[model samples]
Target: DGVEDDAMIQHAQVFGKPRTPDGRVLERALSARSSKSGKAYREVVKLIIRPPRAEYDVKKLGPTPFTYVRRFRGGKQTVMRTEFAVVNQRQDVELKCSQWKPVGAHLHELPCVLYLHGNASCRLEALQVLKVVLELGCTLCCVDMAGSGLSEGEFVSLGHFEKFDAEAVLHELRSGGRSNGKVALWGRSMGAATALMCTAKLDPLVSCVIADSAFASLPMLVHDLLDEKVGSVLVDACVEINQCVGCS
Candidate 1:
């Protein structure tokens, strides 16, 4: 019931306004259970506080270092896509980005946040967030991970394989002369774990990271899933095999 209580608390906060002697304080509003199961069951529920929403005045940014319309193999129509250039490093690559630049935007090399979506999610999932990022005078790049969006690949290595893709995008940005500005990495679920691993390996150019609902480790997450079918020992063995194949 933690989830249930949180839902109820949020609902109460929405409909019931605070009543007080002075007027109506927005603070003191709802009453809820204090403990999971205890004598002190009756208690005023603390309303969840949220950061105020920020609005931005954004201008559209068109065509980066590598932007073009290209067609995939087989008789097909051409579609606009971001392209990347190979950089001199261990599989590091750069991606042409899509951003909305606000008017009067200073040529200041504004910091950027590269967004990595969850399993089966694509760069399109973060478009709304990108708009907000632009409003704050920050740049954003949404990566279509290998096999997930437009990036080339046949299968997803979950976090294990996707981490490489994350590194490639970062390397490309840094190599393409975005070094002077700050870089923040944001990811959700599997992408979040990938971002964390990428941050640990990359240089100081990565300034910060924002991870949403990330698992602890790639192996651990797989182990948890497999444990229900086999056992911990078998799960551990599978992890060892995966490591031997240079998966993690």
Candidate 2:
């Protein structure tokens, strides 16, 4: 019985058990492993303990409505095809967007949000997320991050070249009179990082930003993805590519 108990305790060390005694055994085993692989274990511990960065101001944008379409072309209304642009603007060309209007008292003078999506995602994906923002009495303008939805463009650029397209859309929003100098930029994943980098160049008219799941740096993202796919040796290659062409 005593020998069996010792064996059970050793088994509990690496793989945790549900019960308290088994958990204690697992803790001991972990401590032993940590001691055996001190440096490697410490690296993992640092990764876990790393503090969250102060990136964006998180606010509920509100609930939203949708108008789906077969394609992005505009000019004539057709079945299931809908367009979203500033309701009261002239100078700016109407943008092809998947929009969600919040259901509530309108904040006529408040700012609107321009949402950008991640790789392989489209404006349509913003429906649910925009709805939440609308519920907060904020209007949402989810743009197709060029090449992903109805918007035009050939490459993704991982946000490098893509940033230009986003800037153009914002410029149109502001100049077209659809925007009254009060606009916010919201992005997720790659789009979120793009929004952050864009603030460096955009007009102060962009009052606030909301970036979710953004990486600290562009090259870092590429390195991590490549490491996961082809191992760390490719990290140097990705970094070199990033330096040459500026991609993430």
Candidate 3:
């Protein structure tokens, strides 16, 4: 009975069960499985932590709705399409983006800065960033990663598949002609990993990558999460589940 109790507690802790992402409590847990459960146990653990429904429209955030489409695909026959409605939009001939230029901007092409947000987040989350671009005399384009915000997806794979999603945005910005033949990528949390992974693949893709609050390694983060919490029996299962979810 105690073992079952521990497993339930561990599962809830990792998956943000009982309480929702917004800090609301629902109080929930999956069926407990012992370390002896083998492969079946891992599968069950993996199945329990589904990504929350984080879909949101930027149009609803403000009155003036400016829409731009960013499309990509992943998994099996899954299409992730996003339309961002910003408080401001500058459809430069260089690319299809929500570009906000500095005050007194007379040029069509400006230094473009792409913003990437974290998990359970959307492009609208970059409100502060958009403002900074105005001060820097630059244009900002926020990206909505798959399975989050307006992007189409049932779940998020952390940074694993999101790497591809980030790269796609890189090419997307260059669809027409580049202002100066370079772009800067700035991302937070999971979005940071996506940004770093993209830079790793193609160093010249972006002028520079700014990653905020990104983990050094995913496994270490998982281990730390379970420290002093879950029992040894449930630790392996929980970590495996986390790896699957994170690595996607």
Report the Cα lDDT for residue 78, model 2.
19
- Give the TM-scores of the predictions, in the order they appear: 0.54, 0.57, 0.61
| Model 3: colliding residue pairs | 18-26, 18-27, 18-28
Best lDDT among the predictions, by candidate number: 3
Best candidate, TM-score: 3
Ranking by lDDT: 3, 1, 2
| lDDT of the structure predicted as candidate 2 | 0.50
The local distance difference test score of model 3 is: 0.54
- What TM-score does candidate 3 reach? 0.61
lDDT of 3 by residue, 42-92 (tens): 443433333454556555444432332222321212111233332111111
lDDT tens per residue, model 1, 134-220: 544466676766545544443444565567677776766665654335678889987787788778865456788899989876567
For TM-score, candidate 2 versus 3, the one ahead is 3
Question: Clashing pairs in model 1?
Answer: 59-102, 94-172
Q: Least accurate stretch of 10 residues (summed lDDT) in model 2?
A: 49-58
Worst 10 residues of 1 by lDDT: 42-51
